[model samples]
Target chain A: MRAQSEAHAPSRMVSETDELCQKIRRRKPSIYSELLRENILEVLKCSFPRFGTALAPGKLDEIASHFLSRHGAKRPQFHHIATEIVEFAHRGHELSKPLICLLEYEWILLSTEIDSARIQAPQLSGNTNWDTSKISLNPTAEIVATPFDITLVDIPVELDGTEQNYVYAVYRTVKHTVVTRSLSYVDYCLIDLIRREGEVAFNALVSAPPVQLTTDAIRQWVIEQSQNGLVICGTEC
Target chain B: MKENALGIGLRSELLEALCIQPAREDIDFLEIAPENWMGIGGRKRDQLDILADKYPLIAHGLSLSIADTVPLNVGFIRDVCSFLNDYGISIYSDHLSMCRDSSGYLYDLLPVPRRKENIEYLTGRICQVQDIVGRQLVLENISYYHRYEDQMPEAEFLAAIAEQSGCGLLLDINNVYVNSRNHLEDAVAMVRCLPSNAIVYYHVAGHLELEDGSLLDTHGTKVGEEVVRLGHEVWGWHGPRPLLLERDNQVPSLDELIREVGDVQKSIAAGDRYACSI
Candidate 1:
């Protein structure tokens, strides 16, 4: 009898819960606006995870307030919403450049993540032949420049950022993982050139860079890059 | 990937470990959020290609916002179908919630009302998505924080949608467990009431316990003992199916995850054995 009653306990809970839902339903009205508010809040929380803890006082509030106030009567995608929020944070809040730098870095990761997923593998143009000089940009890659060295946000505030910034590459790997790494100006030039020039020769790509390098050095760099999937060789392309 | 036990989501943090380590005997298959992998190139895409070569891929989309009251994104659906076909992935699922409507992208799954009007709307949308994808999508129950007064019970709503849309269910057992405690619903009864045939897979994940003792489905912590127990019950009730362990946050070391998979495998076996005896 005890065992049987214990088994029946959950069923009893079910009915009680159903009744509770019914009661709540009767008391409350629709959840359209409530859910809209909830979604806005949720988006703010997810996209800007550190607004409250990491950023300066009032920065988060200003962004949220501006977004909610303007977000009237219509819904917008979070990315567009995030951009406006960042802009609001910039204009409305008296934030330090470093702070803006930090926020931009954080937001870029999101935009990059969402943007890359939407890219379709470029129809290879049916080029099965590999040419040493011919190369193209990785459709799944992003190139960004930021000053804050958000790469090093933990260091003291004064040491965090500078007017001088560097370009960084965010690329997807075979594992479908997005990897972010800083790039030297020379390295950026080489890749950006490859992006601009569809398929080119090793000698031609090397010649375009202003910096003088031995043929051996250029060959070595391409060889190194090809290994990393940054620079493709004739057959692989 | 293990061929017959519980699986895990392929998160970015675990990519290197998955590539370096020997095939985890515990992972039956890997669940990829197509939103995370599709169209990405370079090492991540290269590595995913390798992983795909090694194991079967199942897509669980974070976007698609299926319940939104807006025109269907026919182009996006076509792209999704192309991605699935290119990867040779058969099973694609998304949360039975909305992320975007005409207003904008919510970026998170939000619950739809359990009203007849909303149900009819979702039925049409689900069918539209299935038609575009060229396969029926497996819709998962979401762990939502609040609910409005609805026309029917949650299970009935889910069943109705599954029946009307002709879609399958990707039952997230932890959602049932979390929602049960949060909303005062009965998780066990919720599982029992769901149409068993519609259930194509299961998801169990860890959740956070808030200061006030509320359970938040953060997927950042360890899977609680109760959820594992509930997994057994779900398996017994629904019979053998693909059960995925989603750990997006606070992911453990690969070795630890392998052990977790091993543990769930035992529960799956127990559920199967009990079903056989019955």
Candidate 2:
């Protein structure tokens, strides 16, 4: 009889647990409490692990609450949550550049992934022109120009204190793998020039600047970037 | 879907080990969470293409949030349906619990309140999803830490949902043991209460034991003896449905996972033989 009672206790306990939880749920604002906060925090930690590791104990929970208050019941977007975490770490922790770059790089991977799915790749047909000046960057290509090398974001070694301007381009390949290719300072500026001005004449892009890089060098860079599929060639007009 | 044939959850980390010592002949299929693959582009996607080409892929989604109050993300489901069609994936499984409420996704499965209203809600949603996909979806019993104020038993709720929705069951036996340990319910009784024929397959995985002696379904370790026994009992009762070994985190080497798969096959063989003798 005693064994039977002990054996039966678990079902009763389980029933009790359910009853208590149900009771708590019926009274108010729906199941909005520690669980919801933790849910948001867990998703962030799993998706953007570097920040989770960098954050001090209890800090994740704190940031999670901040996000929950803002996000309410809507599923927080990966990039949105990641951006918030980067800023949160910036205010709460040590120097901010590395963590920010880390989040940016990681979030770009996710963005490029989603971005690739939406790309319809309007086919160039009937009088297709492969002009460099007529081209545009692929939908998935994104450039990050930062003072600190974003590659060091994952590496634990200390920064050398020599923060040079660096350009990191995140792009999706034919095989769909996400990769980061670093570019020289000149290349970064030249790429930015085209993107900002939108389909400038070949000669216009190569010249007309304070940095005033040689036309030949700029032409060579354009050929190289164009070959690499970094920029779409302009249409035949 | 193969009767009594073993399956393993495909993990990227185990790819090298698999190449070195390919999975055994008894390992009939591979299971993957479609959410991880949808919108993914790169080496990982390439690897999946290769895997799908090589194996019979079954999609088990983690983010469907089928029971959530928000209207279904029809676009997301459409994306998944396309992926399944592209890969020739025949079955798609998701958890019985909700991953969201009116608010956004919780990122983990939450208990569904076991009430008639909620049952009707799941029935309507499941039927709606089936209509969109043109096939019945399988809902796995999730290992939950908290039981919502359910007016009914888990088994009864699941049975009703399946019967009304025309869905199947992916019985995760490890979840049975984990919930039993955590909540003090009888694992075998829970399994017995379910309509056995509805069990299309079974999920056996490892769990973490907390310091307080309760078990958590972490799927980060080796499947224990209790779970193995429970799986065997399932095979005996169901007369050899499919069994899948799932190791989500702390994945072991390929050899170790295969061995676990092999162990389950042997246990089921033994259990089925025993049942026949009786």
Candidate 3:
């Protein structure tokens, strides 16, 4: 009896592994082939696994394709896919889902730093300290981890030199993280100011200085950040 | 359906565009997303405030989730009412689909079962929305696939919703075409069943076809011939409500979209007037 039970344990373990592998396989072509869909699913799975399961493969693919085609990803580059996914996810899939799904997805993806380098890089500035008391990440920012370095995965051979690879990855990482982090910080600051001083101007959030930055830089940063998720222009903020 | 007059979707992108080209005597009613300006403050609110004074504003919303089984988001409904009260937006509208679930939001407009229960449930929600907004809310037909087995025929379901809710219809010609091609339904028959008196507006847009022969409502391309024909047919019955072009992705130059809008206007005038005389 003891021998039979022990033998059954290995089979059960193998079956579990098989199920997980099948799940990943079924998901990869539809969800992970594009970086944005992958990231959105990753964040969703982490935050609300049950709800995430409800995301139809067809819907995710449609959204992924819509995003890919929108960003001018003519040939489906990983970076383009990732960028589009992040933007769509950040926008909270407005045309398709509830506002909260987006909020929850953004919260999960931005809060977790999959790449240790993203969390530790000193050259990239802004508040690195994950203040539990405050929301440190932007609602649109996402941290993704995959088997392939998404930045290096889809480039042409000539464009895939070591120096280029390193530079591209670094730039992509900084660009996504910085925009997300800065936007989050700005939103947080805006919320805080709204509480402290009622009826705060949108411009005030853009103009306010962080402990280590200038107001002009902050404004420019906010505008740059706005290009992705929020649109900012001429409004007195 | 008289299409030549330019009607701009009250998108945030167009706020600056509107300021640069404020409501001219020729420009038609400005279509505003009710959700965008409802209870929201700051620049968008201020811009809407200014535009409302000049242009005849129509409220469009994405978050109504009229087809959801869950109870209507009363707070959102109240906020929309308050916005309409302030702005005097009579022609309020939303998509004919659900976008929310128990888990908060899926963020994408989703397909709903076409069964009697769904139609009845949605009609109740629409009634509540109409009561709160203090006007008959126009429900736009959505483009979708993956039909449920229990669904009644599409035309019957829509007719039921309109009849029960007493809400007006915003018949999207492009959506009808997309659905017809995808699900192999008769687009004209679908239009025939819709309560003619309740249809107060028409929507026209472009679509992209997938490899599997499925159509997507990308709204990025120009209006196809079939949709244009259907739009003319709709105008024949309903005269013309404020027909608006919605272009979200693959956005062409304003000139191109404007030209398309012009074509719709021409078609509406030519077909409808000729039909009435006949």
C-alpha lDDT (0 to 100) for residue A201 of candidate 2: 69
lDDT of 3 by residue, B1-278 (tens): 24344575655556766666655654576787764455433344556778888888878787787765555677778877887888887778888876554433333455566766455456666777777777888888888754555567777887788888787788888999899998899988888877777777778888887799878787767776667778777777666677788877666555555656766667765763311110
Better of 1 and 2 by DockQ: 2
lDDT of 1 by residue, B208-250 (tens): 7778887888887766777877888887777777777888777
Q: Stretches of candidate 3 above 4 Å error?
A: A1-237, B1-6, B271-278
TM-score of each: 0.67, 0.76, 0.56
How would you class the docking of model 1?
incorrect
Best by lDDT: 2
Off by over 4 Å in 1: A1-237, B1-4, B268-278
Using TM-score as the measure, the top candidate is: 2
lDDT tens per residue, model 2, A1-237:
000111111343334434433333332243335555655677678766775676558867776765544333342233344555555455554445665666666777666755534232333444443343454565578998666666664433345567776787787654455668798777677777777776666666756583576767766665667656566556436
The 10-residue segment with the lowest total lDDT in model 3 chain B? B269-278
Q: In every candidate, how many clashes are there?
A: 32, 15, 17
**Number of the top-ranking candidate, with DockQ as the measure:** 2
The C-alpha stretches of model 2 lying farther than 4 A from their native spots are: A1-58, A65-70, A73-102, A109-139, A147-167, A172-186, A193-215, A226-237, B16-26, B272-278
lDDT of the candidates, in the order given: 0.67, 0.68, 0.55
